[model samples]
Every structure is written in C-alpha cells, then in structure tokens.
Target: MVASLLSARGLNKQFHSGNQPVSVLSNLSLSLEQGESLALTGRSGSGKSTLISILCGLEQPDSGRLTVLGEAFDGDAGRQTEARWASLRRQQIGVVFQEANLMPALSLLDNVRLRVRLAGQDEDGCRDWLERLGIGELAARYPDQVSGGQRQRAALAMVFAMKPALILADEPTGSLDRHTAEDVTGQLFDLQARYGCGLILATHDIELATRCNHHLDLGHQPEA
Candidate 1:
C-alpha cells in the first residue's frame, strides 16, 4: 500500500456550549494517500466541519494526533506550523471553502494568484492554473463583478494553483444551484485527478460522496 500523505489517530474535539461540553469527534481516525479521494458525509451537527477544521490545522483538537507528510501538527508552535503548512499547503494542499472567500477589491487573477505569492511561486504557475480552471478570461475582473459560479471557479483556481498534496473542501457546493454545484464539483475532481492530490471533502451531498473512491458516514458514530 502507498504511504499516507495525511493521517489522524484518536482524533477528538470538544467545545463548550454554555456549561455543557460538546464532544464533536470522538476516537475518529482517518488516512489518505497521494492521489486518493475520499468523501465524508454527515448530517448537520455531525462534526464534519469540526473534523475538517482540525485536519486543516485551522483548529486544534483537545486531544489527538495529526500527521501530515510524516510531520506532526503542533498547535503550540502554530506560527511555525502555519508557516510549514502554508509552505506545504502551497506546494501540496488545496482547500475550497463553502464560500469563495474572495476579496472584493482584488481582481480574479490577483485572488487566484494570492497563494502563489504567499508560496513564493512564479507567475507561470499562477497563470497556468487560471487557464486550466477556465478563468483566464476573467482574470482581470474584480470578485464583486463576477457571478457566484465564476467566483467559486476562481477560488478553485487559487487552491489548485497551490498544487497542494491534499485538498480539503467543506461543502464547497452547498450554496450553489444544482447546475453550478455540479460544475464546481466536476472541476474539483478533475483537478484532483490531474494534480494527483489526495482529496478529503466534508459534504452533506450523498451523491457527491458516491463519486469518491471511498465514503464514510461520520454521523453514525456512537457519540459526537
């Protein structure tokens, strides 16, 4: 078997909602290898987003172990981890959030080119990704000027341009119309295959999950 590019062992996350402790993920474990794609499905409040947050290092687990490319996730050294993850994510991990999350002031090209700049990548890499994602024509348009579908496409371009090792998307199509959602999802998978990036997506769409290599029902866990 191929080595896993990312892994989580004994993953658990808990939060305080008033005086009660809400356990989100309990004893959950998952792994993904390069070029693999897995879809995670769970109903609302099933900890799907929480899990994604932890995996992306956006939030720390109360207790668990996370390893990316053999390196541990160190929240204590988050600045360092962010820098390293930012670099690795730039080189390997692509993320597509539910919202396009574009800056209204920036042009589509600049928005897509943001990570390339952060990663210190070259213009060729940025331009190539924009073209591949079918947004080269709108490169000069500002985010606010574009349609919702176009904005999502631009966001995908930005993430793809990073050429990350893994791609983590949280309900990337949730806000789109069926047609646009399908288009975005199609592009996401196409890029995943093309780039050989491991994909771990948290989605409520069952049909989307079926298209992946493996599917897991996170809501079925005994406790959450």
Candidate 2:
C-alpha cells in the first residue's frame, strides 16, 4: 500500500475568549497523499490556521492522532518534544507564511541557501530555484528592498529549494493584488506539480481553492 504523506483523525482544539471557551475544531480529520493538493477555505476565524499549525507541529491538538511521513503522534501520547517537531519541520515539511517569512537581514539568494542548507539539501541550485520563481535578478537584494510580491516569490523559492515532502502554505498571496496573486499562485501550482509533493493551502479565495485537486470548506462539513 502507498503510505499517506499526512493523516489526521478526530482533531479537537479549544481556546478561551475572555472567560468562555470556544471550540475551534471538533472531531476534524483529513489526509493528503503524495502529489495531491488540498485547499482549505473558510471564514477568517474558522480554525484554518489552527489546523495547519497542528498539522505542521507548531501546536498540538487537544485530542487527535497525526501521522506524517510515517511518523505518528497520538493525542494520548502527551506533548511531543521540540526536537522531534523541529526535525520534521527541517527535513520533511516546508511552510510558507502569509508575510515576512524571509529573513530581512539576508539577501534573497542567501535566504534560499540558508533554507536549503537547513533542510540538508545542496545549496548549489538555490539560485536556480530563485530564477524559476522569477526572482533571479533580485538575488542580491534584501527583503525590504523588494516588493511584497517579489518577497513572496523569494519565499517560494526557499520552500521549493528544500524539496519538502509536504508543503503547508497559509495565505501565501493574501497581501497581493489580483494579478500578482494569480501569477504567484500559478507558479506555486506548477512547481508543486513538477515536484510531485503534497500541498495543503489555506486561503479565503474561492477561485483559488477550486484549482486544487480537492477542496475542504471549514464553513461546512468536510467532503469525503
């Protein structure tokens, strides 16, 4: 049988708003196979980020079972060590945040090289990845010197350079204009397909969500 790249079951999460507890996720479950793309859509406060955080090991669910690349984390297993999660983030998972994911102090090329190095990948092709993302000429520029769209392109180059098994992108183009968003997301999908990596993208854009192989709307029940 082909092993799933990521799997989660019966996820539950809660948070306190003032004195009342709000249930953000209840018995949520999802899975991603290699080379598949899953889009997560929901309202602003819908637990989309929370779910991604849990999946990426940034946060633990109150109760659930998570398995990524064959490594398991049972909710009953208690809190996992930082090292364990760090190892996964470094080697198997590549995450792109909505903004400021690049190191402001480093030049674009250096940032990609650093990320690739951390993933234990060769840094030689870092420049090629940046060029593929359409930011090659800006390799020597710092993050603050580039436009928001360019910076995001650099971030994508960094993520793809690592050749991660699973990619979790949160609002990757939320700050860009319509045209730029389309351009960036188009490259994202194309590169993802070329790499044959699993992708889970959380976005508020309905049209963008539709491009993925599957869609999960947190506003309603998840589709089977």
Clashing pairs in 2: none
**Candidate 2: C-alpha lDDT:** 0.90
> How do all models score by TM-score?
0.92, 0.95
lDDT of 2 by residue, 116-175 (tens): 999999999999998998889999999999999999999999999999999999999999
Model 1, span 1-224: residue lDDT tens? 67789888888888999999988789888888888888999889988888887887777887778898777884455578777665666666677788898888889888877776775667577767778777788889998888888889888888877667788899998889999999989999988898788899989999999999888788887553
Candidate 1, residue 169: lDDT:
92
User: Any runs in candidate 1 off by more than 4 Å, and if so which?
Assistant: 74-83, 222-224
Pairs that clash in candidate 1: 92-164, 92-165, 93-164, 93-165
TM-score of 2: 0.95
Q: Given candidate 2, what's the lDDT at residue 32?
A: 91
Task: Give one clash count per candidate, in the order shown.
Answer: 4, 0
**Which whole-number lDDT from 0 to 100 does residue 183 have in model 1?**
90
